[model samples]
Target: MWRRRTLPAVVALLGVSGLGLITVGVTADPARPPRPPVDAPTRTHPAPDLAPLPRAAPVRVQIPAIGVRAEVVPVGADAAGVLEVPPLDRPTLAGWYRHGVSPGETGNAVVVGHVDSPAGPAVFFDLGRLRAGQEIQITRADARVTTFTVDGVRSYPKEHFPTTLVYGPSDIAGLRLITCGGRFDAGTGNYVDNIVVFATRTA
Candidate 1:
């Protein structure tokens, strides 16, 4: 569970801003087919001998391919026990799971951001465009820059989110970038799918 203070702050900001519920998904669109479950086998870096770094808080994340460069903010579960996201007002800022292992550590590090806000497409709007073998960089407080190589990208319905597969512990440093995707459902005011990018630390 996360501290309670942030929830009220988020609610206060969102209530005044009129930003609707920010859950992941895309409404029905004629051009694109419905999103399919991603069952791609996980791929690791060839250099398994490399060691992970000591735990350190992540300050920022950069993905050159999709032009994502955002500040990292710590977040935990909200009052409803759901993972909290960065405020819609600050869509460009990504939220890191404070309870999870930090990026570059020997475990899965989760980062989440909004796909869009009422104003326009947000920081992670282009996250689904990333392909395997692309690079993701994390700048840490210790001044060490860790680079991760994308293993694969997956999209799953919110109803059947793969909790274990995404949040499971790993022997090597791993990273997961999550955002909204698929067709939007205006009636529900939510997207129909979640886009997840998996990567392993390379340096």
Candidate 2:
């Protein structure tokens, strides 16, 4: 979904794939640790000391291959762990990852946006269509655009989300872009799966 952060992950609060649905509080205990991915790599990173995100107006998101561009909004979390989503300010960016890591930082940079809103199409609705080697760029307040490349994309059932793969500590710079996918359930009103894209930074 072109986002990575704890608040953004809160998007899952909307619900998950029908059969795989497992809300953090309702179905599963939030205290329970998320399952790690199989054959997941070990954390060899010395732990990158990170530079804080610039404070100012929010930034813009751009994907050259898809011809998609929009301004990103910063959101935080509530007492329940659900992140905030931005109001439709003209195809603008919304949502936050209040708990988890931010993009371009250490660990998994999680970003999530609406697949679609009732009123109109939302940003990241077409993110699932991105292919490997595609690039995603973000322009921060410094007026500098950071470039990222998609390395791979995978979908997982909600019941069996790879917690480690999605949230585990990393040894290098990494990313995980997530969104609902698979058959849209008519009853639950959410997708039957989540699409996660693994990416790395280029510059």
lDDT by residue for model 1 (2-29), tens:
4345434432332212122454333433
Maximum-TM-score candidate: 1
- Per-candidate clashes, comma-separated: 10, 16
TM-score per candidate, chains pooled: 0.81, 0.67
What residue runs in model 2 are displaced by over 4 Å at the alpha carbon?
A: 1-58, 88-92
Cα RMSD (angstroms) for every candidate in the order listed? 6.2, 9.1
What stretches of model 1 exceed 4 Å from their correct place? 1-41
